[model samples]
Target: MASESTTEDHSAVKKPNGFPPLLSKKFGITDIKQDAVKWNKEWEAAIASLTAADVLKEISQKLDDSFFTPQHMELFHKSLRSLQTNVAEILSNLLNNGHFDTIWLLLNAAEQRKHILEGLKRASEDPSTIWGPDCRALCPEVTVSNFLSQSGKGFIDFLTRVAEIFGSPITPAFLPNSWWEQASNLPNPWWGQASDVSPQRQISQSTKLVFEVATITRNQFIGEWQFVLSSAFSIVSDITNRGEGMKEVLHFMENTKGHVARCLAEVKTTFRDKPIIRCENCTKTPDDIGQNVRFMVCSVCKTKLKFEVHYCSQSCQKEHWSVHKKACGKKKVTRGLSGTKGDFLWAFSDSDPVANLMRNLPKKEGRLTLRDIGVNPCNGKRSPAAERQAKMLEADKDVDYFLFTASGEPVRFVIDDLGAKMIFRINRGMIMTQPTDTTGVNAIGEYMLKLMSNYPGLSRDIIIKQLCEEYGEDIAEKIVELEQMAYSSDLLTVRCSVA
Candidate 1:
C-alpha cells in the first residue's frame, strides 16, 4: 500500500469489468450519519435501482457458494455489513422520527430479499457481467468477506440467512457470533447434550433446553445425508414441582428470552409466567464479602455472561436459574453428587488465564479488547492479598476529610462509599497513605477492574447504588455529598455537626 502507480491496484492486477468502473460520484450518498434524510434518500435510490444491501438480502442465501472464494466471500461480507449498518441507521431514525408505516417495514424486508436474489442470479448466470474486483473471475479464490469486517450476532444472523437464502451449505460456526456468545454446534465448558438427558431423569433441564436449540440446527454427517432436527431437551418437566422455586426458575427464563431463544429451539409452554431462573449452582456470598463477578461462558449458548454457575445441565441451570451456568473460576472445579460441578467459584492466578485465553482465541474484530473474552480467574491464598487490600482500604480511611475550621485538626476517616469523592475536593492535609504496600499484587484493584471490564452493561449508577446500599446511607452520602440531603432536610445535621 505504498502509493504506487495505478497499474498496481488489485483492480488493475485483475481485469475487473474488463475495465474498472468509474469511481462513485462523491454524491452517491455514502456516509455513517444516522440521519433520516440520508436514509430516505438512500432507500429511494434503492427503490429506484439496486444497491448492495438490497442485493445481499436476496442472494443472501448463497453466501457460502462459489459466489465467493475466501477473499471474495469476505469482501461480500464487508459490503453486506456496511449495508446492514445503513439500514439500521435508517431504521433507527425512522423509528425515532415516527416514519415507519407498517407497510414500509414490510416492503423493506421484501426489497432486501429481492436485491440478494438478484445478486445470486447474476452471479450464477454471468459473474463476469458483475463489475468490480469482487465479481471478476468465476470465483476469485479470495473474496471480500474473507477480508472485511463482520458484525457480531447481527452479522452472523444476517450472514446465516444469506447463506440460507442462497442455498449454501450451512456449516457449524467455528467462530463466535455475538460479543457474548460464540456461535457453534460444538459445546464448550457450557453447552452439550448428555446421553442421559431425558426429562425426569436429567440432572440439568435448563442446559438441556439450550442444547436442543444449538443441536437442532446441528447438521449430522452421514455421507450424503438428510439433516434431522434432534431433541436435546427431551426431558420431562417434573410435574410434581409446582412450588415457588419452580416459579422463580420460570421467571428467569422469560426475561432472558432472546438469550434462551438463541440456545433453545422450543421454550416450553410456561403454564404460568415463566418462573425466574433459579441457579442452584450459584455460590451465595455475603454482599459485604464482595458480589464481584467474572467473565463466564453460558451453559446454554456459551455466550460470555458475567456471572458463572456450577450447574452444567439444563434442569440444574434452570433450577439454578436464579443464577446461571457460569462461575468465578478462581476456585477449582469439583464434581457434585448430582454429577454436576458446585457453583463456579472465583480464583486468582497471577498467571492470568484470561489474558492468556484472549491471546490465543481467534480474532474476529481487531479492535475489541478484554470485552470479548471468557477467562477463569487465578487461584491462590486470599488472605495476603485480602489483608493487603484491607490495609489499603484502611489508608484511604486516614484522610481527615471533615475540616470545619482551618484551626481544627482534620477528622481523618476510613474511606467508605460516602465521603470518598467529596474528600478529594478538600485539599487540607490530604496524604496518600498505604494501607498495604503491595502494588503489583493489589487483589482489590484487580478485582474491581475485572468486574468493570468483563461485565458489560453493568452501569456506574448501579455500582454507586450498590455501594451505597451495602455501606449504608451515611457512607454513601459522605462519598458523594448532596446539597439537599446533607443540608436542607435537617435529618443528617445530627451526624455532620462537630461539637
Candidate 2:
C-alpha cells in the first residue's frame, strides 16, 4: 500500500475542482472524499432530485453515442430499452431498500471512474512524464481488484451487471458456462461480503475499493474493445458463415473496427508504458527468465542516447545488433503531433530513403559506403542529418515512401500518425540491411539531385561543404560534378524532345 503521504500528494496535485461535473452528477455526490454520514446525505439528496427517466438517461449515457454507428447504436438502444424494467426495479430498490452492499458497489464504481479521469487529466498536463502502470506504482491507494481478473473466472463476475444490461445482445462465447464458477474464487471482498466489517470500516474500504476497481476497469475497458471487434469480425469472416448481405455486414463491421481502433488509439496515449520493464532484445522481464538472471542495459545507448535500452543476455544483444545498430546512440527528436492533448512515441529520422538514394546514386565508387547508402555508420555525427531529414519531411505530408533493398527487395516506410506524435515505421524487411554494393549505374541520381536542390539555400557550395565535411573533399567534388552533369543532361533531353 502507498503511504498516507503518497495518497495525500496525489490528491493535492490533482485537479482543484474536486471532481468533474459529469462524474459528480452520475455518482450522486458532491465530493468523493466524504465520510459515510456526509456521503449518504449527498447521495440521498442527489438521487431524490432524479426521476425514473433521469435514472434511465444516466444509464443509457454510460457508453458514448458518437463511438457507435446508427445501426450498431440502434441495437444497443434496443438492448437498453428492453432492460428498462430492470433499471426501474434497481432504482426502486436503491431508493427504498438502499442495501449496504449495493451502496458499497455504487460508491466503488464512482471512485474507479474518478481515478481514470484524474490519470487522464495528469497525462494531458505533462505528456513526457510517464503515466502508465510503472508510474502508477508510485501511488498505491488503488490496489487491483480480483473481480476484474481475466485469467480466472473473476472477470466474469465483474461482468454480471454488464451482462444483465446488454442481455441477449452479448454472444454466448462472451459469457460462457465457465462464467458460472463460484464467487468464492475471488480473493478480494465479494459482493455483500462487506457486511462482516463495521459501518466505519465499510466506508473506508469503499474509498479504497473505488480506486482499485476503477484502475482495473479503465485499463481493461480501453484494451478490450479492439479484441472484441476483432473477435467478432473473425467469426463473421468465415465462408461457411456466409449469408445474404454478408458483404455488407463485413463492411459495416470493418468500419466499426476502424472507429473502435481510433477510439482505443486516443485512449492509448493516456498509458503507453509496458506494465513491466522488459528486455529490449528478447522482450522478457527478469521475472519471466528467473530470479537467477538480471537484465542489462545498452551502455552506449545509455551514455550517449540517454535512453535505456535493455537486453536479457549477451546473446540477445548480439542478435538484435543488426536492428538496434540503426538507432543505437543516435540522436532522436520528440515532435508533438497532437499539440498538448495526448501521449506520443519516439521516432527516428536518421535516414531518409529519398536523400539516401540521392547521395549514393552519384557515387562512381564500385561499392557504396554505409553513409552513402543512408546507414548511420555509427562513426560520424548523425543528428545533423536527422535535423536535415526532419526539415525534408516537413515539406511533404506523404505518409508512404517506397524503397528497394540491395537485394532488389521492395520495402516501404510508413509514417504512422498517432494523435499525439508521428512514428516513422517499416511494415516489413526492416532487418534487411541497406545494400552494401550493387551493379550498374542508377540514373535515379538525376531525379534525386533535382529534389535535393529544391531545399532552400542548398546551393552547389553548400551541398559541397556538407558532403565534404561528412565524407571527404575528393568525394564531395565528384558529387557536385555529377549533379552539374545530371542537370545538363536533363536540359539537353528536354531540348532534343522539343526539336
Candidate 3:
C-alpha cells in the first residue's frame, strides 16, 4: 500500500530506541545527509499519530535499554529533540482548549525526557556499567553521550514554556464563576475553582500542581535511588576536588537528603497497619478469629438494657456477666452496634480519648489577615485601637524574633507589639498571637499559657487532671474545647511527639 521509500523508512526505525539505520552506523561509516530526509518525514508523521502517553512509554523503554552506544546516543538525542518538538506543538493546541489531561500527559513526557538525560549522563560516565559488549567498542570514552547530556538547555527551555502555559491565570472567559461554584458542590471537586482569580484560589491550584509534580519526581527518585545517590556522591566528589560553588552544592545535597527522608517517612505512614480493636470479654480482636466468623452479639443487653457488647464465644459472655451485670443496667460508656467490636473499642480505647482528639486538631498553620482579627486596614475604616495595632504590625514587619518548635531549629519571626495585643509573623503568611484574657476567662487563659510555656510535653491526661482538680470537671471540658480552638487558630503551640 505504501511506496518503497516509505516502507524502507518505516522498517528502519527500531522499537524503544527509535534509531534509524542512517544514525546507527559506526564511527567513520558516513552516509549521505539527504538519505535521512524521507525517514525523518515518516518518523515525524508516525509520532504525530501516537498519543503523548505512547510517546513517553517508548522514550522510557529506550532510556531503560542496556545496548546504547555512541552511535545510538546520537540518534537518541536527535529522536528526543523531535519528540520534544512534537509534544510542544500538541501542548500548545491543548492549552487553547484547557485540556488538562493532555497537559498532564505532556508533563509526563517532559519528565521522561529528563530521565533520558540523566541516563545519558550515567552512560557517558560508565559505558561498560549499563551496556555490555554491544556498546563496549562504540562507547570506549564519553564523547557523543556527554555532549548530548550537557546540551540540556533546549529541554530546560521547553519545560519553562510548559510552566508558563500552566501558570497563566484562568479568567471568566475560560470558565465562569457560576461553573466553578457548581463544580465545587460535586463529591470530588478535583477540578477545584476554575474561574475565581483570587490569590487563595490561584495558590491552591498551583499547590496541587506542585504536589502532583513532586509525587512523580519522588516515584522516579525511588525507582533509581541507587543511581541517584551515586550521582549525588559523584557531585560531592567533584565539589571536594574543585572547592568552587561548594556552599550551593552542599545546600542542594541537604535538600536532596531531606527529600529522601520525607519519602521514606511517607511510605511508612501510608502502609502501616490500622490499630486493632480488641474484645471486652477475651481481649481478642478480629485478627484472632481463625476464619472470618462473626462474633456473637448480646441481644438481651441491646434490647432491654440499651447497651451493646461483643463476645468471641457464648461461654465467655456467660462467665463475664457477673461483672457486666452491674454496668449492664447503667448506660454503656462505649456505645455501638450489638456485634461490631471495633466501634465499641474506638469509643473506649486505653489511650486517652483526648489523645485521639489530637489527631483531629489541625497540624497546619492558620490563615491570618487584618480582617481576621477584627481590624480593617483598607480605607482607614477602623477604631483608633485597631488602627494603632495595624500600624504597629506594619512597623514591626522588619524586626526579627526567634521561635522554637519540637521538630527543628528555632525559626525567626517578626514581632508586632500593640501594647496588650501582639502578633508574630511566621512562615507561609501565618501569624501567631497570645491568648487574650476576657473578664471571666482570665484564669483559664493564664493556666493555658503557663502550661504551654512550662510544660511543652504536657500530656492530655495531665492537663485534664490538673484542670479538673483546680477548676471543676465542667471547666476541664471547657479547657479542652478552648485548647482545640486555640491550637487550630495558631494561638497556642502543641508539641507533637515524633513517631
RMSD of each: 26.0, 23.5, 26.3
Model 2 lDDT tens row, 136-186? 221221222332122212322333433343334432112221211221122
lDDT of 3 by residue, 1-499 (tens): 1122321244354322222222123222222243333322333344335443332222222121222223433443344334334433433433332211111121222332334334334432332222211121221121222222212223333333543433344211111112112222222122343344334422222222222221222222211222222232333233335334344323322222222222222222222122444456776766677687567657767887765577778887897788777767465633222223333223223343222332233433332232223212243233333234345545554433222344523333332322111111211112112212121122323233333434454444644543343224464555444344221112011111100
Going through the candidates in the order shown, the clash numbers are 92, 1, 0
Q: Which 10 consecutive residues of model 3 have the lowest summed lDDT?
A: 490-499
Cα displacement (Å) at residue 61, model 2? 38
Would you estimate the TM-scores of all the predictions?
0.17, 0.22, 0.21
For model 2 the local lDDT of residue 25 reads 50
Task: Show pairs that collide, candidate 3.
Answer: none
| Comparing 2 and 3 on TM-score, the stronger one | 2
Off by over 4 Å in 2: 1-31, 34-161, 164-294, 299-305, 314-499
lDDT of 2 at 176: 23
Pick the TM-score winner.
2
Ranking by TM-score: 2, 3, 1
Instruction: Give me the runs in candidate 3 sitting further than 4 Å from their true place.
Output: 1-276, 304-307, 333-499
